[model samples]
Target: MSESVLKTLVIYTATLVIAVALASVLILIPAYVHYGEIHIPGSYNALYLSKYSPYKTIVVEIDYQPGMEPTPKTIEALQQQIEMYSGKEVLVYLDQDIEDDEVPAVIYGYDIIKITSMLQEQNRDYRTGWFGGNITLYILYLDTIWQQEDQDYSNRMHAASTKPYSVGVTYAADSIIIFKGSLPQNDMETTILLHELGHVWGFGHTNESSNIMNAEFEVYRNGPSPDDVVETWYPKDFSPAQKEELARLHETMHILALFN
Candidate 1:
């Protein structure tokens, strides 16, 4: 090829390459970064109601193993709680050996997952009362006698942690389990059950024993603290105003991002 023609061709090619590189860097890079920011979870700053409706409810069947039967009053208290959440049906399956004629409920054995799925479909929240589940809970029944280091107690804790139960909306877990060697005092039973359920609802322990989440109860099973009640009953759903507030929040965040 002629030298002049070859030199012209080289200059033209280099110009095209530079233009393409500049265009890509100036346009494509920013577009890609912006695209990525849009698709991230909780991005677009949107508000969403839970797929599960707050109104519907379900109750899991509770059964007591050989050593872990709960009391009639405790069972009744559990039922009252279930009712408080909703008028939806509460089912309790008791061991054939224990008879409580005063408490009006039927107990039967059935598939847990199937039941959970049904509850999910119904958009219901299931409450596990301290007394009912074949799944037994332990409490420091007699503080003087109930040893924390007991092998049996340790084994029970291990089993509860390992055993799979549908504990939350996203995953199933063996929730913190408790067992009482003997019946807890009236005040203690209610407080413990309330506190444990608090944990189930995503509340953590607090220094305040007056709080339901406090571990001061005689038998702290699936209980909630006052904090638990606040956490669990606090409307999880965002109202129209809340949605607006969330949008405002996102706007505020974007505005703040400008300074950063």
Candidate 2:
């Protein structure tokens, strides 16, 4: 082979080797160091911590329907739950109530897809992406009566995490919509909020029902009552595995914040 051709081949081989090594590092680092779970929709792994730093405070913004504002007790319960799991300062902010005319357009049914789409349309600012510390969450409380269309579904789904975590690209503008009439006694509302927040922070559903990330929820129905009160059982707290995952995420966020 000519000298120039041989030199060109060597250079191409070296470049291929370097590219493969770099790709491997990117894929393996998360597996070893644990940078949170990869979201299904976006396939990104990192959870975006607010620019305010989790060590200081994580703000939760609530946008409720008229007269459906979460009670102070519910706020306290949510704060306590977040502090317990994340070991971060919890700050709750009540944003203005969603306009009456916009409520119908925002909530089409109990389906999370439709709700998220409507929310994105009406409030483009709330779309998932990197954002500052003004808000880490945007929860919407639907005061209307609604039910899951699935007949076989046992537990009444109180709320859902509309947006998945996207690494570096998506912020924590994760949304949760709760039906006011569906809440049962106990801190059920708080439970649902924490569960959805877990999803926003890159936690997936668990098989263990006692864990806060449990996939199955037990529905509680009032047998004889004029109001027909109903709610789902709330897990007491996060499992050990979940806490470990969250700790890893916090550490990763701290390291990334340092560079930023």
For each of the candidates, the C-alpha root-mean-square deviation to the true structure, in angstroms, is 16.9, 8.8
lDDT against true structure, model 1: 0.34
- TM-score of every candidate relative to the true structure: 0.34, 0.57
- The candidate that wins on lDDT is 2
Tens digits of per-residue lDDT for model 1 on 32-90? 33442222222212111111222233333343334445567656765565444323454
Q: Write the per-residue lDDT of candidate 2 for residues 56-144, one digit (tens) a residue.
A: 45566677667777778778877776666455566677855576566552222335455545654575343222222322445677555
Cα lDDT of all candidates, in order?
A: 0.34, 0.51
Candidate 1 positional error at 247, Å:
23
Clashing pairs in 2: 129-171
